[model samples]
Target: MSIVDRALNVKEQFLQELKELPYDTHSIKLFKDKYLGRKGLIADLFSSLKDETPQNRPNSGKVLNELRQFATREFEAKTVYIDNQNSKKNIGDHSLPEDPYLIGGIHPLTHTLNEINFIFTKLGFSTVYGPEVDTDFFNFEALNIPKHHPARDMQDTFYVKNGIVLRTHTSNTQIHTMLKNKPPIKIIAPGRVFRNEDISVRSYCLFHQVEGLYVDNNVSFSDLKGVLNYFAREMFGQSVKTRFRPSFFPFTEPSAEMDVSCIFCNQKGCNICKYEGWLEILGCGMVDPEVYKSVEYDYDKWSGYAFGMGIERIAMLKYGVKDIRLFYEGDVRFLGQFI
Candidate 1:
């Protein structure tokens, strides 16, 4: 056959093979070698172009380029098809059920803290914060707990260098607030506090506290009761009942522990309430004169009420959580219950 006829025959065979090419690595390689490899049909046809008659050489070159282009397009298309098929195999069946994805949620203590802040803010108390590591003056002495006072022994303190300590309560923020501004101060401090204590179902060495302070002329224990009662109703439920038991604290002259009727027992007997039907929630009293003296505020001109509550304790009471330790443990099963 003439060179032109020979090239046309090879072109027809190449086009036929291209159409039948299989979707797989081995099939693609074989198809390429058969028609497009260095020594394959298309390359050999191009090599023969120089031997063709001058008039036919132009026609031969055009046909050879077309053949080359056709083979290249078919090779790329097959490679993409094969790659897609392999990827689908590696991914497995689409109908199969997927493994569960666990979503995270806020911790119970944090949720309680936010709720407490919201309640106090509604009562016109601005949120304030202070250092977790504070000096003895601010953490203790400035709050009227003296170095020689027996009340100092009440808090199992983690003392740091040079009379500084990890604050045992958020009340340290009270001193910081008072020193910075003059009264009509109404603020709530919320933050983590550290103590030296054994971890137990009831207590942890580290916990959260929220302390509220409101200073102005003529502030009284009745104002304290009114605010806390409103907080109890907002926090627990509209029907929650609250009372104050006489107590003592170095910073507050006439301290009292506030208690709410147990929601679990509805004021009836229950282990959560120790069968007393009441759960102590927090402590409150008028700010002590000594505290004002330490902060250099005139005790005669300014009086306020300060109250504090443990966030963990409040969370435990609200959620019926039996163990304080569970709050710290990173158990997904326990935490997932909150979500």
Candidate 2:
């Protein structure tokens, strides 16, 4: 065959061999050495060109190089395609299914918070948020829990300056909401709160809370019970029961602690509920008249209720987590369980 025809024939044969290659690495390496390697067809062409006339030698060499370049690219692409095909086949049904046990899920706290927000949103409450680092005015005085109040000391707040503090509760956002918006206001503020407490199974320096507020003319105690009852049923189960125990707080005059029947033992009593057959889930009450006055709302013309709950506490009870510290420690083993 003429030199160009011979080179073209070799390239076509090389590509044909590539198409039939076994989808394996060893077979691929053998093909690579036989055609594209240094001692292969293109290398022999260099030696053969010396025998041609000077003019033909250059053309012959050009065609031979072109053939080698095309073949090299084609073979490289084929190698990748074959490797991928083999990889998929090896990972196919003949292979064992991966253990579903190895997979994980969303963090318990995140799951609980999402459920809480979902319920509130369905009830027409808008979600609002504010800064974690706040001034004493918004965190305390604005909420009617001013300096020197026993309630201020109850939170064990982390101070940043003389009066600046890491927010002790999501309640700080309530003041901002009131100041910026007029009544007919309904909002849920969910966020991280900080304290100065010693870390332990039950308490931590930081946690999360979701505080809710609803204000309008004619809001009353019955409205608070109705909303919380709906929340308990939706969060725990349709049959879950809730009760309001009279409580005291600086910001809410008719403050009460909300409790749901112990879900762990289904109100049969459990250690998680301190064996009392009840789990205190949140705090709720009517907003104090002083809180309204701070925002210049006419308390005599409007009345409302506010509620607050710790996210970590809800997460712990839902998942049976014994230690609050487990939620804060950045342990991969602990996190992977949720991921």
Candidate 3:
């Protein structure tokens, strides 16, 4: 008989057998083994295609493929029918309640970022984001961080080719926002930053940051201090005390680091605070005229303030998490505690 005729005969036989087949697990499994197993009839037919005449092989192959597809479709439908029948027969406890699936929660870092965003949003600052993979100008030059600047040493940036890099800080966004928009801008940048640093309890190679910027006709140091004071109070507690000590940053001429009295030690000093009564939370300063010059903003026409905090550090302090590495590791037990 021709291959097509043989295929038709096989399909007919399968249809007859399917009509008489018992709808049970054992019968359906045997049916699958006979027709669709690795060494079953369909495989044997495909293997035989190589022996057919070259000119005729295509048509024979088409018949065999159709037979296989038809058999597969019928087999799947039968299996599903049998399964449904079995399910109805096996209904032993319809009254029993289902075991509840566990619900997940916001990661501690995310929770802290949300809290920071909430506080800023309430203060008339809108959230903004920038690329993790960024250019040297936005990441360093535009922020007034030079190629050989000592501040570069602090970030330990991961360079990508000539002028590209994994952004070392969300401050990159400050430059981008300023360049794209006219002044009277207030924004908070929240995103991941990369650093080539040795991993330890207190530090990790990857972390998150929230950087803030405000530029307008008249902004000042006092305005910077007020915003930070409000942030510390809202994030920690209404009673938490903050301090700003003289510090230096490449992008800001008059820079200071903000610290909050250690909630863990209540200003008495502890290991978490490294025996200091304060925990450094963020860095802030008046926007340097040099930084404005890079973005073509008239330094004479505008003044602004910028501040940034490491989100991981904030989470560590707020949630009492010790190792920064724990935040990255997918440890359900550690994460579940936050929920």
Candidate 4:
């Protein structure tokens, strides 16, 4: 065949190869390799320039350029059409529900924290914050746990350096708030707390705590009970019962452990509650006069209540999560359930 005819035949074969091809990166790459790459039909056509007459060379060159332009336009058009189709497929049935991956949710810990905040916020408590690295004065002394106090042993605190330590409780924020801000101060301090402890199913070195403070004139033990009762009901269920047992904390006078009815069996008891028919949910009490003295609040004029609960513990009970360590471990299997 003539050089022009041979080039035409190759062009026909190239077009045929591309006729049923999908317009995507892979297909475009193959088209370039088979028809436009170095040694491809178009390159062969240019190599034949020497075989043509000088008069016919210019016309032949122009025709070859036109054919190349046509092929390019065809490829570009198909690419645009394919892209539009992909976009349409992605936007399919907007009225329909989204796919599982798109319907992500908050982490269980986050959800529990939100619920706790919501419950307290409704009771006129504002959120408060303080540094995680706290001085011994605020984290310990201000909370009435002296350096020699046995209660400090219970905490297993991690000392950052001389007198400075990673706060063992969000209660440190309470002391900071009390010193900086005055009474009628209803605030909740929610954040992570650290300890020097071994990892286990029920315990971890790092955990979260939500510490609450309510101070004002005539804030009584009854008021403390009322607030905690409302919180227990709001969190566990309206039917859940709450009670207080005599306990001890350095920061509170007549401290008590707050217990909620076993939610799993509605107070009938279960493995979760250790068959006790009650679960100790938190520690709370009438604020100690010593705590007031540390903050320089007049004990006679101002009285209040303070409470603290472990976020991990609450979340575990609420969601039936068996392992406290799961909250710290970023296992996709555990987290995917919440998502």
* Model 2 C-alpha lDDT per residue in residues 52-143, reported as the tens digit of each score: 88879888988888888898889879978887887888776757767777766777788889999999999999999999999999999988
Q: In model 3, which runs have C-alpha deviations exceeding 4 angstroms?
A: 1-101
Candidate 4, poorest ten consecutive residues by summed lDDT: 1-10
lDDT of 3 by residue, 60-111 (tens): 9998988999999998897788788888898878797654446778999998
Give TM per candidate: 0.73, 0.70, 0.71, 0.73
| Better candidate number, 2 or 4, judged by lDDT | 2
lDDT of 1 by residue, 170-226 (tens): 999999999999998999999999999999889889999999999999998899999
lDDT of 4 by residue, 1-339 (tens): 566777688778868876777756887788877767678778788888788999988888877787677777876777788788888887878788777796667888898999999999999999988899989999999888987988877878899898999999999899889888888799999999999999989889888999999999998999889889999989988999888899999999889999988889987768988889998889999889999999899999999999999999999989889989788778777888887
> What's the residue-level lDDT of 60 in candidate 3?
96
The 0-to-1 C-alpha lDDT of every candidate, in the order given, reads 0.90, 0.88, 0.90, 0.87
